[model samples]
Target: MNDHDAAGPSPSPEHHPDGVPKFDRRMLESLVCPRTQQVLIYDADAQELISRAAHLAYPIRNGIPVMLVDEAREID
Candidate 1:
């Protein structure tokens, strides 16, 4: 067995099969909703930054927040 095989693979940033890179969880701390001017909460399960006040979910594309209202999903 080779050293590389024994050491195994190292941890890398998580991403989707589509190649969308996952952003840092700490990024949530400074994000705000453009419409409501309110802080966002990271929804790791859905890969979105949710703005409860605006009732919208902004997508995290390639590890960056697409904060545009047009791109955001309206919540019920």
Candidate 2:
């Protein structure tokens, strides 16, 4: 067998079939709200990180979470 064959198929990039980058849920394990330094809840429907303590909703753009306080929306 050739070296290429032995190496096997190349690893697929982390993305959806439609070309959109996939959000890594594993990141939530280490992620925290910038303002309150508290755990965040993932809102898949809104694509945001909800910080209950801070009353803020951080947006997720292009599959990347915007953790900056300036970028966060004030939640009711």
Candidate 3:
């Protein structure tokens, strides 16, 4: 068998080698701000889930979203 067949398919860009499932963009369709129940914008550069309506920036750590209001940082 070929090496490709033995090692299996390569991981997608959204997946990490550490076995953590990267935050799927599709999640934006379902996930909402706890404070305002508004749609969130994914900031790939900052790795944050931005809630414009709530004026808060929720951090994404290790491919997991920390959605708690207490964990979020206030923004302008």
Best of the two (1, 2) by TM-score: 2
Which tens-of-lDDT digit does each residue in 1-76 have in candidate 3? Answer: 9888999988765665565557888877989999999999999777799999999999988788899999999999
Q: What is the TM-score of each predicted model, taking all chains together?
A: 0.71, 0.75, 0.72
Query: The CA-based lDDT of model 3 is what?
Result: 0.88
**How well is each residue in 1-76 modelled by candidate 2, as lDDT tens digits?**
9999999999864875666666779999999999989999998777899999999999987789999999999998
- When summed lDDT is taken over every stretch of 10 residues in candidate 2, the lowest stretch is 12-21
Question: Which pairs, if any, clash in model 3?
Answer: none
Name the runs in model 1 displaced over 4 angstroms.
1-19
lDDT of 3 at 53: 95
The predictions' CA RMSDs to the true structure, in order, are 5.3, 3.0, 5.0
In candidate 1, what are the lDDT values of residues 1-51, reduced to their tens digit?
A: 999999989988888687878888887777789999999999876888999
Record all residue pairs in model 2 with backbone atoms less than 3 Å apart, i.e. clashing: none
Q: Which structure among the candidates has the greatest TM-score?
A: 2
RMSD of 3: 5.0
